[model samples]
Target: MRRREFVALTLPSVLVMFGFMLVPLYRTVEWSFERVSYGQAGTFVGLQNYLAALTEPRFGRAVVFTVGLTLVVTVVTICLGYLIATLVNGLGRMRPLVLGILLVSYVIPHVVGAVSFSWLFDSNFGGVANFLLGRLTGGDVLWFTDLWPNRLIIALNVIWSMLPFVMLMILAGLQGVSRETLEAAQIDGAGTLGRHWHVIIPSIRGVLGFAVLISTMDVLRTFDNLIPLAPQAVGLGNESIMLYIYNVAFREGAEDLGLGSAISVLTILIILVLLYPSIRSILKEAKEA
Candidate 1:
C-alpha cells in the first residue's frame, strides 16, 4: 500500500487516540504539579503533591496492600488458569460448555459480580459461604471488618474475575503446542509433570508472560470489586491504590485532586517497572523473529 493510503486509513484512529488518551494523560500530568480541584484554576505547587503522597501513612499502607494483592492474585491466577486450561484442553466435546461456564465470572461486570460474591459471605445477607465455614470451623469469619479476612476475600474475588481470561489465553497457547514435540518428550520417558515443565511450558512462555503482564496491570488498578467486597478498606488498611486515589480525589469532602494525580503518576511508574521484564522479553522475541 502507498503511504498516502496508509495515512488516510490510520489518521482517524490516531486522532481519536490522541483526543481520548493523550489529552487526559497530559491534563493529569499537569494537574499533578499543581494544587487543583474540579472546575478551579490550579496554582503551581511543584513536587509538593508527590512529596505528600509519599509521606502519607495511609498512602504507604495503600501501596503495600495493593502491591501485595497484585502479587498474590497474579501468581495464583496464572497457576490456576494454566491448570484449568490444561484440563479443558484435553476435553473433546465438552470444551465449549466448560469454557462458557468458566467465563461467566469474567463476562459479568466487576461491581455486579463483587456484590453477588459478597452476598455469599455476608451474614447480613444470609451468606451461605459464611454459614458453611462457620459449621465447618465453628467460628464466624469477619470478611468485611477485619484486615486479613477482607484481604483474602478481595484477592479471591480478583482471582475469580481474572482467571477465565488467563485460562482462555493459555488454552489458545496450548492449541499451538506441537503434538510431535509432546510425543518426543514422552518417548524420552518424560512424565506428565516433566512434559509440562519442559516441553509445554517453554513453548507457551510468551503467552504466559503476556497473561502475567495483563493480569498485573489489571490487578494494580483494582477498584470496582473493592466497592462491595472491601467497604471498610480505609479503616482496615485494605485500600487499593485506585481506591485510595478515589477517596482522595472524588469522594465527598476530599477533593485533593493534585495529590490524586501525583499518586496516579507514581502508580503508572510502578506498573511500568513491574512489567519491564515481560515487555523487554516481548521486544526481544519480536526482534529475533
Candidate 2:
C-alpha cells in the first residue's frame, strides 16, 4: 500500500481519537488547574491539585488500596488460572466441557456475579460461607465487616470475574505446548511436576506476562463491583482510584472536578509504571525465545 493510502485508512481513527479523547482530556487538564467546587472556582493555580492530591489522606489510602488490590487479585487469578488450565488440559474429552463452563462463567454479567457473591457472603444465616462456618469455624462470620474480609471479598470477586480469561489464556498456552516436546521431556526423565516447573512454565512465560499485563491493567481500573461490594468502608476516598474519580465526578454531593482530574492523571501514570516493565520483558522474551 502507498503511504498516502495508508494514511487515509488511518485518518478516521486518528481524527476520532483526537476529537473525542484528546480534546476532552486536554480540557480536563485545564479544569484541574482551577479551584472548582472543592472551594470556589478561581484563577489558575499551577500544581495545586497535584499537591493537594499528594497530601490528602484519602487519596493516599485509595492509591495504596488500588495498587494492593491489583497485586492481590492478579496473583490469585494467575495461580488459580494456571492450576485450572493444568487440570483441564490433561482431561481429554472432559477438556471441552470444562472450557465451556469457564466460557459461561466469563460471559455472565458482572452485576449478576455481584448479586451472586452478595448472596454467597451474606453475613446472616444460610449463605454458603455462613453455612460452612459452623462446620469449620464454629460459627458463621460476617464476610464484609473487617478490613481483611472486605478486601478478601473484593479480591475474590475480582479473581472470580478475572479467572476465566486467565484460565483461557493459559489453556491456549498449554495447547501451544507441543506433544513432541512433552514426549521428549518425558523420555529425558522429566516427571509431571518437573515438566511443569521447568519446561511448561518457561515456555509460557510470555503468555503469562501478557496475561498479567491485561489483568493488572483491568483490575486496577475496575470499580463497579468493588464500590457496591464495599460501600460502607471508609473512603480509602475511593475503594479504588476509579471509584474515587467516579465519586468526584458524579456523586450526589462533593463532586470536586480538579481533584478528580489530578487523580485521573495520577492513575494513568500509575498504570504506565506498572505495565512498562511487564510489557518490556514480554517483548524481550518474545524476541529471545
Candidate 3:
C-alpha cells in the first residue's frame, strides 16, 4: 500500500485514540501530580497522592478483595461456562434454545441486571432468594451484610452476568473438535469423562485460555454490579478497586480528583502487570502457530 493511502486509512483511528483515550489519559496523569478540587487544579504535590494512596488502609483491603474476586470469578466462570457449553453442544437440535435462554442474562443491560440481582437477595424486603431460603431452612439469609456472604453474592452475580459470553466462546471452540477423535477415544474404551478429559479439552486449549483471560480482565475492573450489593462498604473494606476509585473521586464533599486520578493510574498499571504473562503467552503461541 502507498504511504498516503495507509495514512488515510489509519487517520480516523489515530484521531479517535488521541481524542478519546490519549487526551484523557494525559490529563489524568497530569492531575495525579497536582492537588485538584471543584474542577480546579492546585499546586503540584509530586508523588504525595500516590504515596497517600499506597498507605491507605482502604487501598490494602480493596487490593485483597480485588485479587480474591478475580481468582474466584475466573475459575467459576471457566468451569461452569465449559460445563454449560458441553451440555448445550450435546443437545444438537436443542442447542439454539438452550443457548438463547442462557444468553438472556448477558443481553440485559449491566445496570438493570445488577439491580435485578441485588433485589433478588434483598433480605429486609423479603426478596425471592430470602423467601426460598425461608421455606427451605426456616431462616432468611442476609446476603448483603457479612463480608463472606456479600463476597459470595458478588461472585455469583459476576458469574451469572458473564457465564453466557464464556459459554458461547467455549461452544464455538467445541465446534472445532473433530468427531473422529471422540469416536476413536470411545473405541479405545474411553468413557464420557475420559473422552472429554483426554480429547475434547485438549482440542480447545487455546480458546479456553482466551476465555479465561477475558474473564480475568472483566472481573478485575468490576464495579457497577457490586455498588448496590455493597453500598455499606464505602471507603472501607469489601469494595473492589474500581469501587474504591469511584468512592475517592465522588465521595460528596470529600472529593479528591488528584487522589482518584492517582488510583486510576495505579489500577491501570496493576491490570497490565497482572495480565502481562497471559498476553505474552498468547502472542508467543500465535507467533509459533
Candidate 4:
C-alpha cells in the first residue's frame, strides 16, 4: 500500500482515539496533580492527592479487595471455562444450544444481570437460592450486609457473567489442536488427564493467557455489577477500586476529583504490572512468528 493511502485509511481511527481516549486521559492526569472540581479551575497541589490516596485506609482496603477479586475470578473462570469448553467441544449436535444458553448472562447488560442475580439471593424477592440453601443447611444465609457473603455473591456474579467469553475463547483454541498428536498420545498410553496436561493445554497456552489478561482487566474495573449487587459496599468493606473512585469523585458530597484521578492513575499502573508477563509473552511470540 502507498503511504498516502495507508495514512488516509488510518487517519479517522487515529483521530477518534485521540479525541475520545487521549484527551480524557490527559485531563485525568492533569487533574490528578491538582485540587480539582467539576467545571471549575483547579489549584496546583503536586503529589498531595497521590500522598493522600496512598495513606487512606479505605483506599488500602479497596486495593486489597479488588486485587483479590481479580485473582480469584481470573483463576476460577479460566479453569472452569477450559473444562466446559472441553466438554462442549466433544458434543456433536447440541453445541449451539448449549453455547446459546451459556451466553445469556454474557449478552445481558451487567447492571440488568446483576439485578436479576441479586433477586436469586435476596429474601425480600422470595429468593429461591436463599430458600433452598436455608432448607439444606437449616439456617438462613445473609448474602448481603455481611462482608464474606457479599464478596461471595459478587465473585459468583462476576464468574457467571465472564465464564462464557472465556469458554468461547478456549473452545476456539480447542478446535485448532492437532488430532494426530492426540492420537499419538493415546497410542503412547496417555490417559485423558495426561493428554490434556501434556498436549492440549500446552497447545492452547496463548489462548488461555489472553483469556486471563482480558478477565483480569475486566474484573479489576468491576463497578456496574456492584451497583445493583453490593449496595452496602462501603459499610461492608466490599468497595472495589472503581466504586471507591466513584464515591470520592462523583458521588454526592464527596467531590474529591484530584484524589479519584490519582487513584485511577495508580490503578492503570497496577493493571499494567499485573498484565506484564502475559503481554511480554505475546510480544515474544509475535516476534518469533
lDDT of 1 at 76: 99
Point out where model 3 deviates above 4 Å: 123-125, 277-289
Model 4 per-residue lDDT tens digits across residues 63-159 = 9999999999999999999999999999989989999999999999988999999999999999999999999999988899888999999999999
Model 1 residue 258 CA deviation in Å:
0.4
Which 10-residue window in model 4 sums to the lowest lDDT? Answer: 273-282
Model 3: per-residue Cα lDDT over 1-289, one tens digit each: 8999999999999999999999999998988998988667577999999999999988888888988988998898899989988888879788778878999999997667988898888865558887887889996566777767778888889889999999999999999999998899999999989988999999999899889888888888898888778877752378888888888888787688889999999988977987898888889999999
Q: How close is candidate 1 to the true structure, as a TM-score?
A: 0.95
lDDT of 2 by residue, 138-241 (tens): 96555666677778788888888899999989989988877788889999999989989878998999899889989989988888676557776563233788
Clashes of each: 0, 1, 0, 0
Which candidate leads in TM-score? 4
Pairs that collide in candidate 4 are none
lDDT of each: 0.95, 0.81, 0.87, 0.96
* Residue 50 miss distance in model 4 (angstroms): 0.3
Which candidate do you rate higher for lDDT, 3 or 4?
4
Q: Give the CA lDDT, 0 to 100, for residue 57 in model 1.
A: 100
Candidate 1: which stretches are off by over 4 Å?
Answer: 275-289
